[model samples]
Every structure is written in C-alpha cells, then in structure tokens.
Target: MNGGTSTTTATPNPSTTAPSAPKTSKPGRTSPPNSNSPPATATAPSSASTPTPPTASARSGGRTEHAVSPRLPHGASYTLLALGAALAAAALSFTALAAQFDNNVYDWLFRVHPAGHRPHEAVLLAFDDRTLMDHGGVRGLRRTLASTLEILAAAPPRVTAVDLTLADPGDPAEDARLAAAMLRLPGLALAAEMLPDSSGWQDPRPEFLAAAEAIGHVHALPGPLDEINRMIALERAAGRDRRFALALEAHRLALGGGAIVSTPSDLESGGVRIPSRQDAGRPLRVHYRPSSTVETLPIGALLADPARARALRGRVVFIGVTALSAIPDRLFTPLSPLDGNRPMAGVEIHAQSFETITNRSFIVDAPPIIPVALAFALAAALAAAFTFTSAPVAYSLGLVLLVAAHTLPWLAFLGRLVLPPFAPVAASWSALAACAAFRFFYVRRQLASSEQTTARYQQAFHFVAHEMRTPLTAIQGSSEIISRYNLPEDKRKQMGQMINAESKRLAQMITTFLDVERLSAGQMDLRSSSFPVSGLLDACLRRAQPLADRKHISLEATAADDLAATADRELLEYALYNLLTNAIKYSPEHTTVRVSATRDAHHHLLAVTDQGMGMTPEEVKNLGRKFYRTERAERAGIQGTGIGLSIVRQIVDLHGGRLSVESAPDQGSTFTIALPA
Candidate 1:
C-alpha cells in the first residue's frame, strides 16, 4: 500500500515539475530573466556567483580559444617537488667532493689563526750552517753533537729530543764519545725513520740506542690530496715492531716517561685517547705553534752564549737541522704562518705534533653520514619553503639557506669540528631554483587560461546583445503600430498578434540561454521517463512550424508513434525544436527539413537532415563551439550566435548520448542525436 502511494505521487510530480524545471535550468542554460530576446545562436551567460578556477583545455603547443582549460592536479605538483629533492639528495652522497671543500675551509681557518704568534714552552736548537761551519761541516757533526750533549748534561733541560735519523755509523771513537754524553742525561731521546714501504726501520746506532731514554720514528706523512703535512700518525709499523712518532715519544718522555698505551689504530698518553686520522690511518691533526713561537738558536750560538744556554734549562729542547744548504729538510703545512710557498723545517713539524699531543688539542671530524644527512635536510627545507611560500618568498628563503650552509660549517670549524660546507649549500639553492621554475610555468599557464575564458565571456555578452536587438525592435515597432493608428479591426489584431509572437520568440531565446548555463554547471536534474519518440517530434514540429512557414520550407517527421525513448522529454523536445528551427532559418524557400527517429543495434537515433546552405569541412569541425558562426551564414544575413550546436551537444552528453554532424559546402547538412534505448 505504501509503495503504491509513493509511485502515484512520483508520477504526478514529474509532470507538474517539468514546466517549472525549465524556469531555472533552461533560463541559466539560455539567457537571464530580464532578457526576452532571440539569440543569434547565443550561449548561456556564466553565473556571477559561481567562480571558475582557471584550467587548460588542451596542450596544443599553441593557444586556441576552443580548447578546454582545466586546473593541474596536486599530485603532479608534489611529484615535481619530490623529484627536485631526490636529485639533490643523490648529489650530496659524494663525500669525496664535499671533503675537498672542507679541506679548503680548514686552510682558510688556519690562515686566520696562523702559527708562531703564541708562546710555546718547547724550543728549537737547530743544527744550521753556522753550527756546521763551526764544526767543519758534516764530517764534524758527530763531534759537535757529542760536545753539545755533554754541555746539555751539565745543565740538563727537562727533555731533549734529537730530531735526526742517526742511522748512519760514524768513527767508533766518535760514536763512543756521543754515547757517553747521551748516557749522562736521563731525559734524552733519539729519532728513528720508518722505511717508505713500512718494511723496516732506520734506528739510531746501537751505542746511541743504548744510551737514549726513548726512541721514536721521525717519518711524517703529508696529506693524501694536497700533500701538505697537517696531521701526524701516532704509530707506524716497522717489521713486527711498532714505533711511536717522534712527537708522541717526546711527549711521553716529557711526562716522566710513563708506560704508554698504544694500538695499531690509536695511541694514549697520560690517559688521553689520542685523536688521529680516522679510517685511512691513525693520523692526528697537529695543533701548530707559530714558527717564531718556538725560539730557535744555532747549536754554535747556544754553545757560544753560556747565558743563553742557561735559559734553556727545564725547557723541552728539540735539536734538528734547520739550514737549507745542510739538511734542506722542510715541507709546506696548513699551519704555516709566514709563507704558503715556503716550507717549515721538518723538525718544526714534529715539534708542533708533539705540542698537539701533550696539550691534548685535537680536531674532530664528523662522521661520513653527517654530510649526507645534512644534504637531505637542506633539500627538504627547500622543498617546504617552495611549497608554503610564493616564488619571491621562496627565493629569499633559498638565500637564507645558502648563508646558513657556509655559516654553520664555519662555526663548527671554530668548535674544532670538521663539517663539509659545499653540498648542503649547493643542493639547497638548486632545489629551490627547480621548484621555483616549475611554479612559474604553472602560474603562467593558469593566467593564460583565465584570459582565454574572459575573452569567451566577452564574446558571449556581445552575442546576446546582437541576438536580442532584432526581436526587441520588432516588438517595439509592432506595438507602436497598434497604438498610433486607427486601423481596421483585422489589421490592428494582426499587429497585436505580431507583438505577442515576437515577445514569445524573445522569451524562448532567453530560456534557451539559461538552460545551457544550468546544464554546463550540472545543476539541471533530468525528469526521466519512457515516452514515444513521435510525441517529442510532434512538439518540436509545432514549435518550428511558424518559422518554417515564414521561410516557406517544409517540415516533416517520420518517427513511429510507438517508438519510445527514456529521457528528459522536455529537454529533448527543446533540443529537437532548436535543430528544426535552425534548419528552417538557414534553408531557402521550398527546402525540406526532415526530422526522423530510427532504432539501430544499441541506440535510437534522432536525426534532423536539411538541404540548405551546408557547411564546409572546417566549419563542420568547429560547429559545436560556443558563439561560432559560419562565414557563409554571415554572408547570407542568417542570424545565429553559433552556440546552438554546443547546447545540443551538451544536452546529448547529459543523456549519455552522442551528437554528430555531416556537412559540405553547398550540399546541405545532417545532424544526428543517438540516444541509448
């Protein structure tokens, strides 16, 4: 009983609502309320209240008014941002390149804090040419050294390191004399050299070794890339025996020669874990004293000035060759205060290394992952910056990130940490630029689409004005005739009839305009029901008959009365009426506009064929565009806004149907609407 009531109510509702539905939908699809005018093929005016976002219609490589404009999906924007970040992250993983920039930064820092300005406790007693000349050159070096050792024993210094490879044997008597002198001083140390291939060692003579308090290797390895001596290995292998570097050994002896903790990769003195080169070898970064900080005097000068010799008491003294002509032993270093091109003597380098270890001053290099992680962080920041901000703001953020890149590393360097500065800065700016460019192009395309839409609206407005002018003039002229003259009853009645017809024509055009707008916005709800095709065709013929009679064109329908269609009857009637009217309007007198309905395999086809001035291939191709008009129609003074076919197509699409036209110049045209049965 409830279902019967619901069905009965629904049946009446559609019929009662059918006429009123066109009041809103068709008016929006055709024209507005105040517009009771004919449309020269006019289209619906866009709603002022509803804003349309700009979008691209097609990617034609060139702009065309007919192409659709649609907004870019958010997914594509996100994908571009991710792509930029991934590329940046990939580039940052090359640690070697980043490390090179770090090395350069360190060089600059060393320049700012040059060596030799600060006072150093350790002193250099170099065996220069002056000492050599006094002792008769190399031949008398052993005797001179033996004499110096005896003087050092009389007024013993805290510690004395002989930074020389005393591997070569000398006269037995001279060796014995040097050995006796060395035994007198309990704080004496001798230097040894490791073989280049780490196979063996060049130790001091057996007599000298027996006398010395400690022995350590004097070999220093330069940096792998720049070949500058910036660090020193704490331990080196000599055959099966491990040898400490000269600096480590000297520091140990200075600390009262305690039991040293040593390993292949690390060393410890006084409970201090020695900071050394990581991964490659156990090389420790040297904390250098200024070249002038360690006061140097020739051995002859120290021997000549007894008072000066007394000042060396309780000081750690390193004795090595400094004269270029004699030993010529010097190498460039990062900590070179005076000249980059000139080398600091080898002995000075060893002295600085010893100072570094004894003072526990070390530089810490961040782990390899630090740079890679920072690179990703910077990339993500740039991505977010672009995402949240406009192009100009994002660019400003990029500048800030660039500054941070260099600043952070510099601060870390000051804190005794080695952080790479190159990759993070480069990646941040690159990612920013890529995202910015994508955004710029996207905005440009959107603006172009908006402009095209505006142009379309402007054309639609003009079309409405042009279309309404004709009927408005006719209505005014006919109304004036009926009012001004006292004509015969039949003549006045005829003039009055003309006014009513013109008014109705104007009203229908407005309705058609509004219908298009509503349908396009998907606001038109179809009142679907099964109805005979003949009924729809009969209504269209009745409406188009007046226009057909004016043109003296024949209007015929060949649809079977029982051939039915399931669709919005009123909307379909409006569509068919438009086709019939257009055919009558464009065709010459005595032409026939045939309306027919036939069923095929899957669809019932509603076709309107005319033998009028047909369109060419190009005109047919562009027939469905809003506000389009053919040049042939224009020449023949035919009235149309060119949007009739556009409305027809939209109506067909709403019904899940298709509309197609076949035409050629001078051959007339056929328009078919295929609706599923």
Candidate 2:
C-alpha cells in the first residue's frame, strides 16, 4: 500500500491542462417590482466548475487546490490571458466607464447610415419662413392653418395631427375658422403639451379642443447628455390626467376614429395591437429616416392650390410651423444634417415617430451580454493565433478580428438591432494589444533563456574540449614513442597499454558528448532491451576504476545478480558512467564510493553513494541543474563541466525513471535513480 501510494504521489497529471473557457455568469435583464406585480429578481445560470490543473502553486501546496486549469496549449496561454483581460474591460465599460464609449460608438453607427425607409402613410406640411412670407406672417398664420385644414377637410386625410400648440388663445375670429374646420374634419387630432411639474396640460383654445376629434401630447424628452431627441414618449401624465403621445393617438385615430382604447402595457384600438416599450421602461427608439423621406409641402401652397391637397388624401398629415423665426421649431436628430447646423423640424420629428409606430419599425437592441461574450471569445481566438502562429499570420488574424468586430454591428443594424460597435471593437483591440504585449514578453523571455543556455554550453564545451586534449596528447606521445624508438620490451609494452587506455577514455568522452547533444535536441529515442542490473553496475565500476584508482578511491557495487531492467542498455550505461565518474571525481582520496540496486514490489532503486565532502541542502537541491556547480567544488579545483548530472537525469527520465538526491553538509551525498521493475 505504501509503495502504491508513493508511486501514485510521485507521478503528476500532465502539465498541458488549461481551462476550457472563462467561467462567468451573465446578468439577465430584470424589471423593478411594480405595485401590482410580485417582487422578483432574475439571474443568469451559473457556470460549471472548472477543472484544476497542477501548477507551481499546486505542487507547493502538496495538492491540486488553487491550481489554475490549463485549457490552452502552452504556447496559447497568452490567448487565455487576453480573454480574461477583455472580460475585465467589458465589465468596466458598464460601471466606472458608464458605457459612454459604447454610446459614442452607437451614435457613430447611427450617423453613418442615413438613407432609410420611412412609412408611406406619414407626410409633413411645413409652415416655413417662405410659407409665412408668402402668406402674411403670424397675423395670417391662423388663416393659413384654417385654410389648409379646409383643403384637408375637403379630401379628408387618414389623420391630420397639427403639431402646433395653440395654447394661448389665437385671434378669436381666426380661431373660430380653425375650430369650425377642425369640427368639420373627423380625422383631425390636435397636439398638446403637459408641464413637467404635473401642472394642467395645455391644448388648443377650449372651443378648438372641444371641436377636435381627439387630443394627444406633443412633448418629447431629450437624450440625457446630448439633449438629442431620439425617442418619443408614448404616454405622459399630468396629475390625474393620462394623455397618449401625438404619434400614438394619430395612429389610433388613423385606424378609424373612435374612443381611444389602450391597456396598461400597450395601445389597442380597432383590433390593432401596438406593443409598448417595457424593457427598463425606456421610450421607444425612433428609427429615423432622412428628412427628405417625409413627403413635404409648404403650407401656403396647399392653401393656394386646393386641388393639390388631393395628393394628401390617404396620408397622416403633420402640420407644424417650421419657419426658423417661427419659434426656432427644430430638434437635433440622429439623421440630422452632417453640417451639424440643420436640425430636423419638430413636424418632421413627429412624422418620423408616428411613422415608426404605424409601421412597427422601432429599433431593438441585443442583450448587453451578447457584445461582451462575443468580445471575450474573439480575444481568445486572437490570443491563440498570436501564440501559435507566426507574426505575419497572427497579425493577419488580428486584422480579421477587427474587421469582424466592426462588421457585426452593421449587420445587426440591418436587422434593426442596435448593437453598439465600441464594446466589441474596443474589446478586440484591447485583446490584441494584450496578446501583443504577451507575445513580446514571451519572445523576450525565451530569447534571454536561450542566450543564457548558449553561453553556459559554450563555456562547458570549451572546458570539455580542453580536457580531451590531455588524453589525446598522452595517446599521441605514447604511440609516437613506441614507433620512433627501439626501446626495451617492458617499456614498449607499458607505452602500448597507456595508448590503449587513453584511446578508450577519449572514445568514451566523444560518445558521451554525442549522446548529450542528441538528448538535448530531443533526437534520442530510447532503444529498449532487458539487461542484468549487476552487469550494468559492474560495467560502470569497470569504466570508473581507472579514474577511481588515480584518486586512490575504492569502487564497490552490491546488487542482485539476477535482477534486470527493461531500458536502452547503451543509454543506461552512459547514465551510470556519469554517476560513477561524478562519485569518484567529487570524493576525497581514499574514500569509497558505493553502488547498490534494491527493488520493491513496483520499482527498482539504483543508488550511488560517495563518502566525500557532502553538500548543503541548497547545493543538493541544485545538483541536477544544467551548468550548476557549487562554490566549494570550484574552490577545490574539481574538473567538471557541470552538465553531467543533467544528462544523467535526462536519460533516466527517458527510461521512465526518477532521480532523487540526499545530502547534508559534512555527511556525504547519495544519488538515487528509481525505475519501474
């Protein structure tokens, strides 16, 4: 059980695990509790729990807790990081930023698309400066209105909503003519204004109001910051009096005049159901068409040519004084002229609002969560591309993301969904910037690490090459002496032996260096075969005997003669060569180095122990780090390139084994390699 536990604990889950996606809950749109409705709050469904992967923190905690799940490839980690940043930015857009940026983007989209379709039934009759001058100023304005109404009454329009607020009494005689004309027309609905203070509503002269078929409020609320009129309130209240908007009343009367009927949430008249704005109780968003789309005629012309009024027979005629001097009667609109000075006439604004209601072309918006979710998803995609792809390809993908962000809004606009462009564009750009930053840092880190490794390897290569010269020089000198001189048999035999030993050492050094290179480059595949553990240990001892003899150290091995391992024989031999050689090189003269193999039920342990100047725990901890050598080893003039143990560890890992070190200052050291039996 203990052995099983140890094995289970030793091996870890793969390092490639990452979170599949960001775990976030979207807030559903909720309505405030109405006096007659139950109190309630709506929340989006919660996300599922994410799998935790073992990270540095997890390992240090000795458990999987606090582990960050790895859902992305190692190179694509930047993509996930960017997604997190995009979500944060999007959330901020709703709070501290207050969606100002988002609104601005929407405003831009609104202005860029000006050519729009307007309802065919709504028409504008402007009492402009030209019409006023052609008629005879304010004294004649009432006559002009009365005359136009008479002409409209002759043919009878579907509905005639005079946007004129005839609040204060007009000339009594002229008012009588207007009232008479209004009474004669059953399709006529007059406009009125309600005071913000809930004071009594204002309407045309009492006689004129009494004579009109119906009365509707003409007051509109401007947008909060810009004071732009984009939406028209469907209804307004003045104390006990509830009045519908001019557009709503006109629409109702146009469907055939009758007692206006409506429900708490909608206006219903003559079996026509017009849905009211209920989301957050916001006013209906006006889908404004160009000012030119509302067929317009000067009020004077209609009065001058009574026959021309026949063309206005089936339309809902909106009559208002748009003369610049006629009270500067204009408001800023989304489709306002590009010059920024030309505001749409109040009459035209009313026409557009009424047309919007009649045609049911009100603008809709996607849920707030949509743009946010899409932004994060795009950011993730960009991050992944930036991480795994080349610079040109990643940049191209980023461009694609940008185009996608901007284009989606236009498509949504076509569908009458007012999807703000800024959040997505801002999110995508922010994500790209974040991913770019990550790529920059990632490249920098890799370059710095690579440069450091190169420097260490270059230095180690020079040292090892220098060491090779000594053995090569010995072989060359011994061989040259044997061939060049007529020496005694004993001296010749000794020289020949020296040359042979030096040749063997040189060949082993070359082979080990080549193996290290191949392993570092990931080109070495294990060539597995079964071999006796004793044979391997004995071979390592024999290889190190000459070096151990030079230091007057005894080499010893104790292992089961029958025990064997299933791994590449040549690779194991190289690993043991490094271990045994290091044991001999680091130990003091006359010290003994012990090699032993022991097995449990699941694994075999091969330990190399040396009674030498041991290391501090810190030193032992750093033993297998490439090119890491202790200060004591440096001071003691030990000849080492510092990568031998690194190579040994790599080989053991390739053979599905683990390397462990045990050491303490002044207590010697033990290096253990554990492999499955």
- Per TM-score, the best of the predicted structures is 1
lDDT of each: 0.71, 0.72
Clashes of each: 30, 6
Off by over 4 Å in 1: 1-97, 115-119, 129-140, 262-267, 277-280, 325-329, 335-340, 464-612, 616-626, 643-663, 668-677
Give the TM-scores of the predictions, in the order they appear. Answer: 0.70, 0.63
Error of 2 at 445 (Å): 2.2
lDDT per residue, candidate 1, 1-677, as tens digits? 13211110001121121111111111223332232442212122212111121112211233222323336544356346745664665575465665566677787877775543444667888888778888878888888888887888877888899987789988889989999999988778899887778799888989899988888887777766777777777777779987888778778888888878756555678677785643557777786655756678789987787567677788888988887787755777775645545677888888888777766677777776776677667767767777777778878987787688668777877777767666666666666666677777878987997898789878877877777776676556555544544556875665566556556666666665665665566655555789988778776776566556545667777775468899977668767777777776778876788888888989999888899889888888887788888998999977666776777778789799998998877778889999998
For 444-519, candidate 2 gives per-residue lDDT tens digits of: 9989989988997787688678867766656555555445555668767755665666566665555556556656
lDDT of 2 at 41: 15
Local error of candidate 2 at residue 46 (angstroms): 70
